[model samples]
Target chain A: MVHLVIDGKGFQAEEGQNVLEVALENGIEIPHLCYHEQLSPYGGCRLCLVEITRGARTFLSTSCTYPCLEGLVVRTDTPDVLRARRLVLELLMPLAPEAPRLQALARQMGVTETRFASDEEVDDCIRCGLCIRACAELVGAEAITFSGRGERRKVEPPFGEEALNCIGCGACVFLCPTGCLHMEDQDGVRTLDKWKRTLSLKACASCGRRYLPFAQIEFARQKGEDPPAEGWFEFCPDCR
Target chain B: MGKQAIERIVEKYGSDHADVLEMLIDIQEKEHYLSRETLQYLSERLAVPLTRLYHMATFYEALSLKRRGRHQIHVCMGTACHVRGAARILEQLERCLSIKSGEVTPDLQFGLATVNCVGTCALGPVVSVDGEYHGHMSASKVERMLKRYSETEANGVAVCQK
Candidate 1:
C-alpha cells in the first residue's frame, strides 16, 4: 500500500493502483469515460485530467492512466484541470451530442454548447472503445475495430469486409457506451447491425424458443477440452 | 510455396509477439500485400489473435491488405510537392488510368496513391513508380512516364465483369 494526497485528503491505496481508481474509491469523483474496471486503461477520454505534484515538480495527467505512488499529491479540481476537462468535453460534444451520459457530463461540467462543428453522419458515438475492448478482452472475439483517424475514423470490420470469426455474441452491443451498436433477433436469425453480420439462434429443446446464438454456445464448448453429453447446450436456463 | 515462405518468416522471427510488426513487413515485402489467408496463418503460427494482425495492418502506413498492382504510383502531396503543381500531376495520372487515387487499374498494371511527404522536399512535384522516384514531375510528362511500363502483367483474377 502507498499513501497519497488527493485534494488535500490523505488516503492509502494499494501498490500500482491508478489514481482514478483510488480517487473513485475515496469518493473523489473524477469524471471519466474510457475507464472500465474490467478492461485495460485506454486514457482516450482525457476527462479525468488531474494535477499531480511530487516534491517540487508539478504536472497534469489523465488520472485513469497515472498510477499512485508513495508520497504523491494529486488535485482533481484545479483551474488547469477544469480548463482542460471542459475543453475536452466541448470537443467531444460534437461527436456524441445525443448521448445521455455525455450530455449529462457536459452539463455537470457547465458545457452547454460546443465551439466545434458537428457532423450529422457520425451518429451518437463518443468512440470511447468500450465495445471494442469488451469484445477483445471478455468475449475473446474481435468482431469489430476502430479504423482510421479524425474525419476518416470508423468502427467497423477491417477493409470494409464482413466480420471475420465473429460469433454474434452481442458483447459489443451490450457494452457500447453510446448505444451506437445494435443487435436484434428475428425468425431464428440474430442480426448484429453494427457489425453487419447475421447469426442463427439456437432453440431450446424443451421450450422451442431461441435463447442464444449457436456460435456463442459453440464458442463456449470450444473453450473446454471435455465434450459434454448430447443436447447439453440445447436448452435455455429456465428449461435446464 | 507461399505458405512455406510465411512459415519460414515466422521461424526466422522466432514467433516473438513484439516482432510481429517486423514479420508483417517482411511478408508484405514478399507478397506485395498482406492477404487474409497469410495473416491468418501468421496469427496461428505466432499464437496471436487475427484481430491484432488486422490492427497492425491498418495502423501502419507501409502495410496494405489488398493485392497491389505490378507498377506502384505514389504522388507526394507534401507541402513542397503541392507547391510545385503536384495536383496537376496527380490529375494527369488519374486521367491516364481512369481510376481515382488509392485505386488500382483493372489489369493490375498500375496503382495510384498519394503520400503526405517523402522527406525529399527539395525534389518538388516528385512522383514514384515501382520505387523509382521521378522528380520535377509535370502534367505533360505523365503519359511519357507511363509508356515506360507496358500492360499485360497480371490477369486481374478478381476483375469486375458486367
Candidate 2:
C-alpha cells in the first residue's frame, strides 16, 4: 500500500493502482470519462487532471494513468485542474450534446457554453472509447475500433465494414458511458444496429423470460465455461 | 496477409507484445495501409487484442487505416506555417485534388494530409511530397506542382524540379 494525500485527505492505495482509482475508492470525487476499472487506463478524455506535489514540485497529470506513489500530495480540486477539466468538457460538448450524463457533468463543472462552434449535428457518442475497450478487454471480441483521426475520428467496425468477429456480447452496450450504443430486444431478437448484427435471445426454461443472447452463450460455451449443475443455459440469472 | 508474412513479422520482433507498434510500422510500410486482414493476422500471431492494435494505429499519425496513393503530400500546419497561409495551401490542394485533407485521390495517385510541424519553421508553409520538401508554398503553386507529378507519372521521369 502507498500512502498519498488527495485534497488534503490521506489515503492508502494498493500498489500499482492509479490515483483516480485510489481517490474514487476513498470517496473522493474526481470527475472522469473513459476510466473503466476493467479496461486499461487510457487517458484520452483528459477529464481527471489532478495536481500532484512531491518535495515542493507540483504539476498537473491525468489521474487515471498516474500511478499512486509514496509521499505524494495530490489535489483533485485545484483551480487549474478544474479549469482544464472544464475545457475538455467544452471541447467535447458539441460531440455529445444530447447526452444527459455529459450535460450533468457540464452543469457540475459550471460550464454553460462551449467556445467552439459546431457546423453540423453530432451524436451522443462522446468517443470516450469505453465500448471499444470493453469489447477488447472484457469480452475479448476485439470487434469495434476507432478509425480516422482528428475531426474525422469515429468508432466503428474496421474500415466502416461489418465485423464478423463480433459475438453479440452486448459488453459494449453495457459499458457505454453516454448510452450511445443502442440495444433493442424485440420478438426474441436483440439487435445491435451499429455493429450491424442481431442475435436470438435464449428463453429461461423456468419462467420463459428472455435471458442471454444466444451468441454470447455460445461464446461462453466455446471458452469452456462450466454449465450449472442444475441446467444447461435454460435458466436466467434470476431463475437460476 | 499470408500466415507466413505474419510469422515473419513475429519472428523478426521476437513475438514480444511491446514490438507490436514496430511490427505494424513494418507491415504498413510494406502494405501502404493497415488493412483489416493484416490487423486480424497480427492480432492472432502477436497475441495482442485487435482493438488495442487499432487504438495504437489510430493514435499515431504515421499509421493509416485506409489505402493511400503512390505519392503522399504532407502539409505543415504549425503555428508559423498557419500564419503564413498553410490553410489556404491545404484548401487549394483539396480543391485541385478533389479530396479532403486526409483522403486519397480516386486514381491512387496522390494522398494529401496536414501535419502539426516538421521542425522546419524557417520554411513556413512547407509541403513535403514523396519525402521531398517544398518551402514557402502558395495556393497558385499547387496546380503546377500537381501537374509536375502527372507529367512524371506519364513520362516515367523524375522531373519535379521543385
Candidate 3:
C-alpha cells in the first residue's frame, strides 16, 4: 500500500489508484465531473484541483489524474485551490446553468453567480468530455466527440452528422454527470435524441420487458458463451 | 497527391499513439487542412477512431477541419498585442478581405485567423501572413500588407470599412 497525506491526514492507498478515487474512498469529497470510475480519466474539467507538495516543490494539480505517490502532501481546501475551483465553476456556470449536478456542486463551493458572460447556452454537456471518454474507452465505439473550438466548443457526433458506429449502448447516457443526454425506451425502440439515432432493444423472453439493446446483447454474446443453466439470448436479468 | 502523401506519413508515424499530434501537424502542413478522406485514412492507419481524430482536430487551433486558402494570415491577440491595437489590425484585414476571422476569401487566396500568442511579446501587434511576421501593424499598414498578396485585385471593393 502507498501512503500519502491529504488535508493533513495520513491515508493509505492501493498502488496505481488516483488521488480522487482514494480521497472519495476515504470520505473526502473533491467535486469533479468528467471522471467516471470505469472510464479513463480525462482532465478536461479543471475543477478537482488540489495543491500537492513534494520535497520542495508545490503546485496545483487535478486530483483525478494525479496518482498517489509516497510522502506526497495534498491540500484540497487551500485558498489557491478554492480560488481556482471557483474560477472554473464561474466559467462553467454560464454554459450549463440548467444542470442540477453542476448547480449542487456550485452551492457546495459557495459560488453564487458567474462574472463571465456566455453567449452560448449548453443544456448539460459542459464539454467536460465524460461522455466522449465513456464512448471511446468504456463502450469502445467512440461515437461522440468534442466539436468546434473555444466559445463554440461542443460535444457531438463527428462533423455534426449521425454517428455510424454508435451501438446505442447508453454508456454515454449512463456516465454523463450533468444529465444532458436523453434517452427514450418505447415499445422496443431506444432513442438517443442527442445523437439523433435509435436502436432496437431485446425484449426479455420471459417477462416481455425491454431490458437492453440488441447490439449490446450481441456484444456480450461475442464476449463468451452463456451459462447452460440460464441461456443468454433468451431472458433478461430480472426475468432469469 | 493528398492520399498517397498521407499514407506515407502514416507509415512514417508507425501506429504510435503518442505521435498522433505530430502526425496531424505533418499532415496539416502537407494538405493545408485536414480533409475528410485524410482523417478517415489516418484513423484507419493509426488505429485512432474518426471521432477521436475529429476531436483532436477541433481542439487545436493550428488544425483546420475546413478547406483553407493557399495563404494563411494569423493575427496575434495576446494581452500584449491586444493592448497595442491588434484588434484594429484584425478588423481592417476583415474589411479588406471581405471575410471574418476563420474564413477564407472567395478567391481562396487568403485565410484569416487569430492566435492568442505567438510567444513574441516584443513584437506586439504582430501579424503573420503565410508564416512571414509583420510587427507593429496598424489599420493603414493592413492595406499595404494585403496589397502585397494581391496586385491585380488591389482596387477590389472592400465590403465595409470605416
Tell me which of candidates 1 and 2 scores higher on TM-score: 1
Model 3 docking tier (incorrect/acceptable/medium/high): medium
Q: Model 2: per-residue lDDT, tens digit, A80-153? A: 88998999999888777777888999999999999987547666777788988888778777788987677778
Identify the runs in model 2 with alpha carbons over 4 angstroms from their true place. Answer: A225-230, B1-10, B14-17, B75-116, B134-162
Quick one: best TM-score, which candidate?
Answer: 1
Query: Candidate 3 overall Cα lDDT vs. reference?
Result: 0.84
Candidate 1, clashing residue pairs? none
Question: Which 10-residue window of candidate 2 chain A scores lowest in summed lDDT?
Answer: A223-232
Error of 1 at B102 (Å): 1.7
The DockQ score of candidate 3 comes to 0.66
Across A1-240, the per-residue lDDT of candidate 3 in tens digits comes to 889999999999987889999899889999898887887787878889999998899999999999999998999999999999999999888877878888998999999999977665456567888888887776677788888777678889988787777788888887777788888999899899998878899888899998788777666655455423446667887877
What DockQ values do the models have?
A: 0.37, 0.47, 0.66
> After TM-score superposition, what is the CA distance of residue A88 in candidate 3 from its true location, in Å?
4.5
- What would you estimate as the lDDT of candidate 2? 0.83
Candidate 3 residue runs with Cα over 4 Å from true position = A44-47, A56-60, A76-91, A106-120, A221-231, B14-18, B77-92, B119-125, B136-162
Better structure of 2 and 3 per TM-score: 3
TM-score of every prediction relative to native: 0.85, 0.80, 0.82
For candidate 1, give fnat to 2 decimals.
0.24
